[model samples]
Target chain A: MTTTHTSRAAKRPATSGAHGRHPAKSRQRPNWLGGLVSWLWLAVVLIPIYWIVITSLKTQSNYYLTNPFVPPGDPTLDNYRLVIEMDFPLYFLNSLIVAIGTVIPSVLFSFMAAYAIVRSSGANRFLRGVNSLFLMGLAIPLQATVIPVYLLIIKMQLYDSLTALILPSIAFAIPLSVLVLSNFIRDVPKELFESMRLDGASEWKTLWGLAFPLTRPAVVTVSIYNALQVWNGFLLPLILTQSPDKRTLPLALAAFQGGPYGVNVPAVLASVVLTILPILILYTVGRRQLLSGLTAGFGK
Target chain B: MSAITARRTSSAAASRGGGVLPWLALPALVAFAVFALIPLIGVLLLSFTSWDTLGEIQLTGLESWRQVLTDPGLPHALWVTFLIMLLSWGFQTPASILIGVFLAGHQRYRELLAVLYFIPLLLSSAAIAITFKALLDPNFGIGAGLGLDFLTQDWLGEPGLAFGVVIFVVSWQYIPFHSLLYQGGVRQIPRSLYEAAELDGAGRVRMFFSITLPQLKYTIITSSTLMLVGSLTFFDLIFVLTEGGPGDATRALALDMYKRGFQANLMGAACVIGVILVLVGLALALLLRRIGGRDPYASQLEGA
Candidate 1:
């Protein structure tokens, strides 16, 4: 469907402009609108985050009396103490268990599947079909399938357990992970594989020795991505698990906000802060990998 | 014994130069089939039977569908869902593009802004909804503290304002992600096009429209598809934020399903809603792909 005119309309520049690193270095015309919107959007994003952090530090009484925009006059960790006292540590551990449980198997299996799909090189019908199945899986909303997943979990007697969360999380993570990992795997040089083949290396050996090293960054990206999804997942825990002890951070956060402690705004915001702190730390540690991987992963 | 024989035969097939690659995909395939694919079909089947969460399912053909279809709530839920999908897409697209174009600049400050901008995306929807819920409280919220009477409106208490709040919060969480996509898209645009336009004395606005907008067609499609389809799963945020609001004003289809199935104990009815949700998502995705004007099954599977 791409007409000649349409294809040429936004075609890549013929010169040395590779992947838009430095777009128009000479045409330094000031972008007033872009600048204005950038700064404005920055405020819109930051103010709430800023409010959440500072307000979390405030006493509930001070939160009521003080200028909401201003930093707390007297800071307190009482809210944090209160939130932690409410078994947040349990929820945090449950989230951690679920995240780790989901990420490892999900990433490993997806990596294996992706390697198979990429290695088949479009010649293998079964691999091609599997690849397409994963692609179709991407478009299916998780909400649509939750009902039966719930039933399956119950039937398996895995309901109300962390394993219940882990199983479904692994399935949901596979499609996107396979897509991204396969894309990365396809970029590995065919010559390398052929060279391994010449040395009488098994496909599994080449997969581990060559592709694994080359695609480690993608693996990390997929790991962090899946970790985030599982860590922040709300619905599965909301429905599958019933025990208070089995609550993940998100499900626990919702419960904390809606429970009898709901009226304690400081404690509520404190719990929110607590739930986000671990990911914030992870983000800080792997900002570039996470951000760039996300950008390139989706912006193709 | 049967499992061993099957494995032996598969290994025999694999050793015959058919390659072991296909076998490597088995774990993921089994997992997806059990938990995702089967559940998809299971949901459809469940819609034909009636079961509360704790009970034995009863096969009662189109009865559940009939009840769901007759209910006035279904239309309202669909409308609310459609409104959120449309409005959120409408609101997020332009802003994300502008900010994306802005962040595409290679300035140090813009880099810093990009860092902070993505923080909201890092927060779980539950966290974002909870934060917004507390922050927008009419009595104990920012408006009361700042003494801004206009801002002091019952944000989540009133129906219209609650719907608007839901859309705004969704945008606040997602625009960072879409803008990041736009930034990457903008970064991929050929610089020479801008150079050519510049030589012709094109202004910033002119270059953006003539060059940037057209070049970003695919990114727009990618982001739009995620936004439109992802809005269908806006359960946790809406559930936590307004619980579908004062009078079901913000009750989306997913939330409606949850209330019906989990709260009201109508599993069959909920499955019908789930079926509708699946169909709508598939239809929208196909529609967007059609608009993209590519081979329907083309291998451009780049998304989060």
Candidate 2:
């Protein structure tokens, strides 16, 4: 941090501390050691991403023979073609359906529930109880309840279907979403609701007209966050789905990697790239929303 | 007198409308009850019974629980989990704070640095694990590319070393997450304090101890709580990467539970381990929340 570095430079005797490395003349001097470490971490983070991107472009011959961390000498799009031949698009479509299916219902339900919880007067006990019930869902790890969830899906004959994945994912996603949406809704001015009520606006009208618009940012945040979670989820699909046709991208990728295609390194990397691209695009567009949403939930 | 009567009727209508308002939560409540609460109760009940994943739910009072308690490999799984949490605290937590502090500055590239670092977080854990699995290949891998062949051993091969590399990978995926937490905390420390400290000639080291750390105490608690619980209960990465191998060297409780239930055909025993995982995670979260004192962010939830 420049603040830390500058303060360090100011505090130390110029003869001793200043000469350890570069001379500090700038008012806001970068911590070179910290910068070095940060860049190294940047490299650590990027090299694999670089490897996957470049490897996806390299021929299988060079993929094994050449250094993986280096840029590809000879490149090809055939790996992506092979990945497509493996029905990567089907898996991608399934992931999209799941993400959309999960986000829409999860956000809608959390929004309405958060509205009820926030709008309920202090004496309203039933709504308060509902709020606490959702709060309790926060700590219930999916791993713990997973076996029973599988049983329930089996009982409903929904096992090995996308429905099984979406239902449980929605359930798991609600707690944090509700907590965040409720907090955001609470920040909405009460007078707006009261005036709407006084003006003979139906509760539904007021809710849709005022609350929805006011909390639209929170809506986007929860939608993107939940979509990201559903897109990236592995355990649910792994445990729930059995048929190859129903396997999500995560399951598909893992199976693709370990199957006979394991030797086809570029194709596997291509699968990885294909699976992750949408969410990466989502992150690029909604970085601030995702960060603020999570930090608000955790920080609060 | 007419105004008062009109207000009373409007207020009465408000209460009547509010009666139907609470029913809006029924969908979420039903989802929670069916998916979260029911399964939670099911896991607890199944812990005491004996059955495979299907068929008759034969209740045999503590049989599965007793078996899990007396199992030979239970301690090792737990120990591996504990090592992960400890190593994460040692490795990930400090790095997170440092990176957080660095990114908290007023520099131009801090934004780019942050976006770059979050790449692993955006991608799926399975993908990251698989890529790292290739990169750690001693010959013809990233280690070779960097010309650090001496630096690249069989990183995931040895028994003791397998668990440690898993820790590194775990930290790699998560350090950015905790760094984001700390970066938020660092930004929350008002700029004026830094200015005053700068004027007072209190060095960076002095300010970090005297000002920064004290301000960040609660955040550190939350970050540590997340790191501990998350690392302890990890499964997916290990599952895809090593399949809990070189011979149970990397099998934590979650992995062991999966293997016991699905692989070994011992669903009831798996539920018992699941119960322990739940209780441990719940206990750890609550205990950390306890140590965290009051929820400082509680006041923020009410209307501004």
Candidate 3:
């Protein structure tokens, strides 16, 4: 037994030393190569974006003739100017309104429903079942629902209205939002709830005072996800709205491409750049929450 | 105490408390029912009938379903969708995992790399499509300038290549998301596990397989399932990049559904396609749920 212990103790440092030495060695020379490869990958990824920005700034004359890699001979905002002049602002506003409009109600509803589902005791199993059913919504691709949604929107006389966009967006967002919020809520201490209950706090008070405050990260995640979905939505908006004034950015841009000036590459790129600015800003700010939120409730 | 209990009881009675919380769900329930559930039901119903937008509806039973099963357009579209999903998911998923693992180790540049990678997520599909269009343009585009002219093709207009371009664009947009998932999962694995693995004389590869891989099982399932469902339903990028293109080369099921339902006014056929999409999504989701049913939070808590 003594010999075995000694051998074990003797083996320990050698293993530890080997383990410690490896990451240290990895941390030295090879790390630089790894970093270099990462940087190269980053460059490859960023090139298309760089090209977009450059092409968007070129004038019509230089756009076709200039080397695509180099900045335009006389760089101009003419493409952006054209997009603005051509009612891109209206599309932008329409998109913003629809996205925000959808996010608010969806978040509110999902929050309360999630609170109820997480806090309620006797119906927990039922709620879980319900939640799973709602998750089935994820499986029901938008293509399947577009026709029926369109018909329903028209029947309700909501066609050509921003309300049509808002309603559908909110509906689609609820499942994921509720899923995220519920998972976050599950993490809150039961002791806190019991303490609040002893203090005569109502469910609403507990939700607003305790749960919402703690679940801010999850809330932000859901909001950003919902916003991205709403902002980038295409098929629903395409089918529901008919008028140019009601068109979202994607629809408007599609029209720009398919219009008489078919494949005006530079102008299209400019419009595309302009449209993505808001989302890019949001992503840059809230990327962590967005990503964690996406993965959190995605599985079960 | 008796007086306080009586007051509480009376207040609770006054509040109509039992229904109030359920009432809160009413707005969302109504919205979902009206906009999602009802439409879905309508689509299922409509799938069994043949109707153009302007014509009288006629009961078609399994006719639309049969056509969807056999239609040359649908089989071609399904093949394209499967191919795009296979290639894009194959390329992007592993790349995301590697990037995620790499970034997880490097604390200093993690945020910067993440931001750079995620920039595409913020951009609109239309914008990405247009940007790619300019970048891939044959004669004067940057692709040509970089001696990539050999790689250049009429991405939107070419039958053989448009699907590939669309897949690349979609993969570029979504890879950051997958990476983020894996990174989160990696962050949740206990540092002690790494130390333990090291103590066991495990090399990096051994540690990754034994410690990291087992711990990240949930994340991998979740991210891959998301990718699978997302890829199968993918529409926006393809719609903008190729518009079911040059000869239906890039026509995904979603796009095909759109064409039939709206553009061609064949609502029944579109509904059938939609049903197929739902079935696929359901199968994938169920599979993912089974794999990820274990406590995902336990790892994070242990790691902490």
Candidate 4:
């Protein structure tokens, strides 16, 4: 209930200014506190990332001997070699397979579904119902559904398969993709649809020629967003796949922490670094699109 | 013969102005039904039965719900999960808002800081967990090497600090997300509003309260809902970091669900907790929606 007042207090030191409102004194005041905290936060975020990258590069013995906060006196890439030898590339390929497998289908299906929901209004109550069903799916927590998903996969004989990971993820991603894409699709002028209709374009033709072009930004956004989710998802792969050969990158990384690499922290961290490198590259390139896409419906 | 006739009837119906909508939406609908909606319905029914991963399921009505009610570890788990959620909210929300406010006002390197802070969000929680798990180890960890021996406690081992470390890692992963929300919200405030406030003798702090915070109400609602739901269901990092160990200190509901299903071989019990989790999430979302009154972006809602 106090989310309101508690939020105000969190703003900090505004009570005195509430009455004072002294423009002159406040104008030149730099946000030193903000600056200090932000920089400190930057370090807090970077340290673990830095720790892993440096640790991954260090000679194992040097990693044991050197200050953890300092760069390694003797750098090495042997850990990467060790991880790669341990089928890290297989796991990476599996992750890529699952990611591409999930994203393409999710984006393609949801685009058609959203297009139908948006363009086929007025007596197309079925489309509207489908749209709402997808929206409700948003509230269904993934963790809650894990058991049933596991059971269903096993029932379908897809357990321990990459196809198992791909199928469920594509299903789960549809809700958000539909929501974001439909939002974009609704903004397509109704006149364009009517014009296409008069021009004798089939629903499919207008959908592909007019609506698809208009919603390309959304298509890209949903594609990257779905890719990120599928790439980073751990639970699905954890429950569905049992074999080392079938394990995705996240499952592989989790494995490195224990079992074979338990004693080799650098090797585990090397795996970590390698696992994130591709996604990090993508994020750097498409940071704006990804952020906006993730927060798409939240603006509502 | 039935399948052939059904296909012919579908073509006949489509040619009769039934439109291509159902056809266009068939793929999504099929995917949703088989994978999402059916699984959801299956979980609800499965919660009433006992089953192992490799064995036959037996219907045992009210038993799993009773088990969830009676399980000693569950309350502690729920309590721990709730505490983490509160701490996370306390940890991430205000800090995000403040940092967001600061960045919105600051001109230099704001984007750079945002990008950097978001690193944790991009990387796998498993990766982050492994890195921190190693870093926090008392014997061989960075804590020992950096000579910040004071900062070096048994991060994931000692019961009290293990929970704290979990909270810290959770915060580490999520704070940037809410901050990004705040930054976006702050950007939405019209520049003219700020100028008007300044001319009316409002200070930065005052303008923030009187104008900025008021305007950011919806974003706050949205972010808080996301964070609360996210914190409750949080699993991957905690799973890798502690495995809910150090005497069951970080046993969140999600972890408990995992244990009940896989470790205890009690699939029914896990689903009960899952249902409860869904209920709690729905309740909170509704509660926050009411508190939030009307969404400021209702126009956008209508656009969709």
Instruction: List the candidate 1 regions with Cα displacement exceeding 4 Å.
Output: A1-29, B1-16, B295-304
- For candidate 4, lDDT tens digit of each residue in A22-114? 223445577676678788888999878888898889877787788776778778889999989999899989999999999999899999998
When 1 and 3 are scored with TM-score, the better candidate is 1
Q: Provide DockQ values for all models, in the order shown.
A: 0.44, 0.33, 0.28, 0.34
The superposed Cα distance between candidate 2 and the true structure at residue B294, in angstroms, equals 2.0
What is the C-alpha lDDT profile of model 2 across A1-300, one tens digit per residue? Answer: 112222343233444553332212244345555567677777877777887899899887787667666678668889999998998889888998998888899888888888877777433678889887776666556667788888899899998899999999998999878888887777666667778877888767876899989888778877877887888888889889999999888889899989998877778888899888887887788777666655556662
Q: B1-304 in candidate 2: lDDT tens per residue? A: 6345435543554466667667777788888788888999999988888877757878999888789889888998888777777887899877888887777654446777888888777777788787777767776466765667565788778887778778888878988887877777776676578678777876666777888888888789878877777765677799888889889998888898889988887889999889888888888878877888844334335421
lDDT winner between candidates 1 and 2: 1
lDDT order, best first, reads 1, 4, 2, 3
The global Cα lDDT (0 to 1) of model 1 is 0.85
Clashing pairs in 2: none
Clashes of each: 0, 0, 0, 0
Per-residue CA lDDT of candidate 1, range A1-300, in tens?
Answer: 111111232232333245434444556667777778878878988998889999999998888889998998789999999999999999999999999999999999999999888776655789889988898898889668899999999899998999999999999999988987887777676667767776888878978899989989789888988888888899999999998999999999999888999998988999999999988898888886777555444554
Residues forming the 10-long window of minimal summed lDDT in candidate 3 chain A: A1-10
Give the per-residue lDDT digits (tens) of candidate 3, residues A1-300: 111222233244356665533242453334343356456667877988888888788876676667677888677887888889989999999999998999999999999887766565324444555565565665556556788888888779999999988988898888777766776776776667767877888878988999999878778777877888788888788889899999999889888867855466777778888887776776667555565555555422
Poorest 10 consecutive residues by lDDT, candidate 1 chain B: B295-304
Residue B125, candidate 3: C-alpha displacement in angstroms: 1.9
Top-down DockQ ranking: 1, 4, 2, 3
